[model samples]
Target: MLAALIRQAQQAGLSPEPGFAPKELHWLAQLHSGKFTGVLPLREGKKGRQVARCPELSQPEMMALPRVLGQTQAAHFLADSCGVIALLPERAGQEVDAKTQAKHGAYAALLERAAQDLPQLLPVLEVLRNPAELAELRAELAQRGAKATDRLSFAVDGLDLLESELWYDWWRRFRRQVFGQPTTTGTMLDLSSGEVVTPAKTHPKLNKLGVGAMPTGASLIGYDKEAFSSYGLQAGENGAVSEENAAAYRAALEHLLAQAPVLGQMKVAVWFDHRQAEGQALIDAIENPATLTQASETFSWDDWDDTEAIQIVQTPEQQAAVAHTRAQQLLSALRRGETPPTLTAQYFALAISGASGRAMVRDWHTGSLEQLAEAVATWFEDLAITNLSGKRAKRPRFFSLLMNIQRPKPQSTSMDDYLKPIRNLQLPLWRAALDPNAPIPFSAVAKLMEAHKAQVMTGQFSEALSRDGDGEDKSRIYTRMALLKAYHNRKARRQLARGQGGFLMSSSVDPHHPSPAYHCGRLMYLLANVQDAQGSDVNAGVVQRYYGAASSTPALVLGRLTRLSQHHLAKIAREKPGLALTLERDIAAVWSALGHALPKTLSLEEQSLFALGYYQQLADSVSRRQDLAAQRKAAAAQADPHPATSPLAETTQTEQTAQGE
Candidate 1:
């Protein structure tokens, strides 16, 4: 893996040499003939600051920048205030300690030493050595409103000292010599390269290779204790990777980290075979398959330009059309046994997280694109539970699915704290998406079950239209059902692979399912529907009153609810005999499927099945009710071709009839 990353870095045109790294200089110290001229700010007139020319670095230029790790008192040839100013600024409140004085001396000395081989650095070193020139540079910075602490690099006669190849070559050679020399203290070795160093006891820290997105001070490889170092290796000695390969590996990893997609606290980097254009398409397919389905028809590669100033706004109808198109494509593949085009490119993904200044490897996955495609297809196929309209619910992104199961937060909880628990599971779920054989986390299933219970018991159905005309969001419920269905389907798939009898759950409710728990769930939905049939809204409906108990201990709660359902059915019989009779027949069917008695208690998985049955049955019921209302409207239209009735009144009457009004 390390070798592959190093190769990727080299291919990406990153600096393959150990000493070269890019540094963002905020303020350029202008010079003329080795004399301090003025201070030029990089980000002037942009994002609340003023400057000229921006001074952006080209890829090659950035790679060629001289790099070094001067942690504290050790100063770089190009450095901040303490290294450039002999006397600290008063407003800056920086003390000119003995160590700070040493840094300024060291900075000038290094440049002077390198000036011999690189004459371009000579002018910059002359200005730094001159106390008068240094004071003038500081005063000029103050005049320009540049922060005293801003990073400073010299530009002599229109040439950036950092960009000078002579300087870069000289620094490279000096760094190699420094690392190769012996130290009085026990050696610190580079974990990736096994190169020895002094002062610091372990490898250079990670997270600095990229922007601040990577965790600060996180050690990807380190050994601080005696127990961790083995085979007579000294503490912090990395013996596995030698100096020859470490530099290349670190460079490659830094390139990957810079563009790696982040999810909550985890960073996932993907690398694909050279044949592939990029790994982003594969990642999008895994993380959000809906985007990949019918993508070519709905969008063009040219449509997304990072440099484009104006974003094209999509209408809701367009969004719906895209979703519908994806649904049709996925459904067609499943029904007609059509295969997706073969993907030959292979890819690798590494998931890492940081905590307490340590880097943790969450997961690593490597597979052909075909495996990923199939895994995603199977994921959606098994998870495609019906919506309120009884059509396949739109597939959700992996992140959205996880968000659905996120624990409910109190108003006092911060957004980050609320999301922490869910964030911790992102890597595992991502791995599961890329590997069909992997199991969905049981904790996720349990959380979904809890969310379902809360939705039902609180009478706050997601995207549900209740009898009282109260609107509630049902997206959460849909997400829960989708996950539940996939959970059972994957479990069954594994069982079948082992030659054990296991049944896959359907997207819609299956009346003849073998599990009694499924029928109980259906019964629960039917009983609730029976109560809903009553013209008047009840403050406490069957679901709100007993869903928790009915789902878990059906034998105890469902029997009582079943008996009470008769009273609910009887009260609505006079007003809407049709709806009442339909409810009666549905209840009987579920009871027959459930057998003579319900299960005494349901296990966690069985309880999930019960929730699935309830959700699917509710979807079936709502869909039928809507169809019945539509049929009534059509028939009434035929009866009165030009009746003097408002459409609103007609629709309201139709809705009332459907609800047994």
Candidate 2:
């Protein structure tokens, strides 16, 4: 990983030479050598040292400027102290603080020394020397391309020396003549590049990782403890790399982190140095896969331009069409025992967080883009279920699955402290997504089970759609169902690996042939449906009231539920023949599969299957409704070649309904 990162840094032009591995320094050189016009001049506030403004320059030349003079610490001077004068006019207290007085004194001494050597900087020094003339000079500076927030630096000719030349010359001379070489404590093997070089005492820090990790940025690589050192080597020397290499890696990491997608504490980034284009395409493909073979216009590369802003028309039908296309393509490749070249690019992902002041690398996943796409395809297939609103989604993303555990706050990493226990499982879940063989973390599974059990016991039907009139956020039971199914499928694969019996993960309920636990689950849903259909205004149906008991101890719950269901069926048969016949046939088919009796009790795994069975049965209702609608449409078209539409047609509805609905 270190070598790969080093290579990436080299590709990024961060490390210019074997010995010289400067971070922003090399970046600065690139900006200067390139065609930049000017820099934004940020001025300090009148009250404190905060940047008050970085007003624009009128000159077209300045607009092209790239950022060269970036944030720097370590004995640096700014305009408030070094150039012109401090905004003492605005401060109520006239007494100069000791720190400010000392800083200005140093600046004055540096100017005097520079005046003695570099004669061209005389005018700039003259301006810095007078406090009485500072106000007029600052006004002039603003119009001349300096912002109120600018650190007053100089240029000789292009507005005189361009400020770049003045600062660059001074800094270069300072480095060579005064700053000299960085102090090196010991020579050690460079782990990053595999060479002997002087190691840095401490690595650079990782900044801007939301709040509460640490006030100061976290150190990416550190060794403060004696136990961390080897052979009596202190601090960073234990995993020594030259200061140059260290700087390079830190810079690269910082760059990647800046663009990474963050969710709560987790920050995620992906890379594919060798075939970046292909890898990005694969990522997009997995999100919206192509289910069809390539035709002349089977795939459109134009659809994947993230750099360009474009409006998308994403209707449900359009999304479903794309998902179908992607799935078909994936299935063909899997059947053929080959990975598509377009999807075979190498890929790597990193997930990071901050813990106190240290960086916590949550996950690092590496695989072929093909493997990733294939895994994603499987993930989608496993998660196939009707959402709470009775609408089908192609597949839920990793973040969507996470929301089932706990939702992230908008625009920030401020997850509720109460959710910390479950939030910690997010990393393992993300890893499980990338690798099919990897088991979903047991902790995460337990959390889901616990939450489900609680919901079941409370008899609160959570997944009321937005249109349900209650105006509550829909429940995540569908996603919970998907996750449990995926988990058990992986567990089953593990069984297969150990030369034991295993079950295939199903996309829909198979009443004809399902596990005994699945049958128990189906029975529960059936009982609930009968009670709902026969009764009026039942606040919570049988499944909602007793799902916990039925799932855990099926034999004990089923007999009572079965007796109540018989009463429901009898009433339905007396009142509604069409629905009654459908319910009766459905009951017989499922009961036939269950044989004579229900299982006595369910363990964790069986209970999970029970949830799947219930979810699948629920999802099947949507399919059955769609099929009924299609059949009606066919009959109407047959009766009249083109049926006339009217308000009457809108008012009318299907008389026959599915038992579950």
TM-score for all models, in order of appearance? 0.78, 0.73
Candidate 1's C-alpha runs over 4 A off are 23-72, 79-105, 126-152, 181-203, 208-216, 228-230, 235-238, 275-278, 288-293, 296-343, 415-424, 462-473, 534-540, 631-643
Q: Give the best candidate by TM-score.
A: 1
Tell me the lDDT of candidate 1: 0.65
Q: Write the per-residue lDDT of candidate 2 for residues 53-99, one digit (tens) a residue.
A: 11111111122111212112111222332222333322333454554
User: Model 1, 1-661: lDDT tens per residue?
Assistant: 6656666666666664544444446677788877777877775453222221122221222223333323233455554452344344546555556766766765666666677787777787777777788778767776666654556777889987655554555565665565443354435554444455442334344543332233334656667676765666663343444433444565566567666766656777777664233235546555665555453333322332222222223875554455444443433453445554554566777787666656677788888755655666677777788876768877777767777885456799976777777765676677777777787888888877777778778777622544433222556667778888888888888999999978888888788788998889888877766766543222246678888898889999988887887887888787788778787888888878877778999998899989888878877887877787898889899999996889999998877877762
What is the number of backbone collisions in each predicted candidate, taken in the order shown?
A: 12, 22
Best by lDDT: 1
